[model samples]
Target: MRADRLVSLVLLLRQRGQLTADVLARELEVSTRTVLRDIEALSAAGVPVYAERGRHGGFSLLPGFRTELTGLNHDEALALLTAGSGRGERVFGLGSALASAMRKVVDALPESHLTAANDAAQRFLFDPETDLLSRRLDVEEVPKETMVEVRQAVLAGHKLRLRYASRGQAPRRCVVDPIGLVTVRDKGYLLATEAGTDRTFRMSRVLEAYELPEPAQRPDNVDLERVWAERCAQFLSEGHIAVQVRVNPARRDQLLDMAEAVRAETPDADGWLRLEVTFQDLWHAEWAMWQLDTDAESLAPPELRSALHQRARAVADRYRDRP
Candidate 1:
């Protein structure tokens, strides 16, 4: 702990050139007394650091002992020091980490811009959702530390023991060699190889993760990005549910203009539109059909189409009986 403070202190003094004890303690998360002890340690190690005691006095290295940080311009320095406060805390974990690192950058800033860095850090913020579709889904019940370790294992090319809960079953355990980590919106995925087969484990679905003694080995000649894309394609393809609908050319054109893909022959001569698209297992297809009304006609996929007609007929029958 003392060593950590000492190292951070040296780094601080070298980059900052001069800093008040109060400021160093605040940045280092230690007391002024602790910072003083650290300064003494640095001095003992012949670091050429010294302290001043008066009101305007603080710590500064002897002349010719100052070290400067590399390659940070004024705006860049300000941006780095306070880049996360504006983004409400739930965006990217790595972004949060970078924000913490930015504080260190602020500490390293030249005295002339210290005030600006402090001001910027307090005001800088970003929202990841502005560019992403935010959705909430069931995730595994694992601790953040466990997830961090699992991610590190994937990066380190290590095998992991995963206790996962399946969609409709109790928790099952499996051993997997992690190859990559994927962030699909709010979901976290660990792309791995199990028994020579590629598998993806969702982090939120994981109940437990254990690092195995087997050194992590990456798969040979495998392109993880390609594999992940293929998996996503397959997932989308599996959801293909056909729906046929009747809509006038005016409506069909409007739909097409809106980028909704139309399936089968588009002419529909009679103003009917046939379209098929992928949908998740959880769907409100019938309700959506009802909402679309006469503008949408379910043409193919006999089961859903027939059901739609029957429901319409039933509604008519109910009206007739009521009259």
Candidate 2:
């Protein structure tokens, strides 16, 4: 492990030219003292590493220093190819690029590991868009150019002029600072800030986008995963309607997904589950229960139960005469 970390330290300096000890330690997940010791060791070993004192100075290597450690191992190559194969259909308009990269990876693998990696990669299949019933998940499709534009703005750290489609309203135009792009379950979302307020936009609802020359106003040290988690938690904490239900054990996972939180649970004698769950709203609660069909029963908030009853009755009445 020390050997690998040393090699990584060299690679980072080579690729990025110069870095402070604190930055290097953070990148390598080590202490600043450890980074200093590594630097001394590399210098003693004639690697031409040197440090400069005072603020605005860190560590650097003599220009043109290089290493020969760019090859990916069999497992790494296989992981890339497998991910490429699975996400080929939704790669932000980079399907061709991914295919070309995969080919290069396969060609670079050693003869001994080639066949085994290929077989391993082919054994796993991922197609989340198609459910067990063979029904395709309904998702809005974003134009390739729109996705590309949003990506460029985010990468370039530039302001973006966006025309967005809001539900039940006309498409509105606004200028926002593009922070990042993320894909969840094949659906894309852009996290940005509008007028200094955090906002998240569905990529498919983006009618058009133009990258601006002006730079975006955002913090330099942004942790995207942390930001995304915070946004998700905030969204999940509001506007929930609590209810109780009795459902088949088999559909517990589906119920959990629909509910914001599960407050309590009790196992029924007949193997059904009685759960106190909170859904986003009355309509949402009704919709999820209806989908469970005979396998579940909604048991609280007379209004939700009443809505479900009316919906079920309407369906039964429609089929009473048998088409």
Number of the predicted model whose TM-score against the real structure is largest: 2
TM-score of 1: 0.57
lDDT against the true structure, each candidate: 0.65, 0.81
Per-residue lDDT tens digits for candidate 2, residues 45-144, read: 8998888888988899888775332476778767776787765656566654454445455545665576777788888786666767575765657888
What are the runs in model 1 whose C-alpha is more than 4 Å off? 1-70, 74-96, 110-125, 128-142, 220-222, 239-276, 282-302, 305-323
Per-residue CA lDDT of candidate 1, range 76-182, in tens?
77765544454423332354344345545655566667666666656655433332324333233447667767866766767898899866799998888888777
lDDT accuracy of residue 145 in candidate 1: 62
TM-score of each: 0.57, 0.69
> In candidate 1, where is summed lDDT lowest over 10 consecutive residues?
131-140
Highest lDDT model number: 2
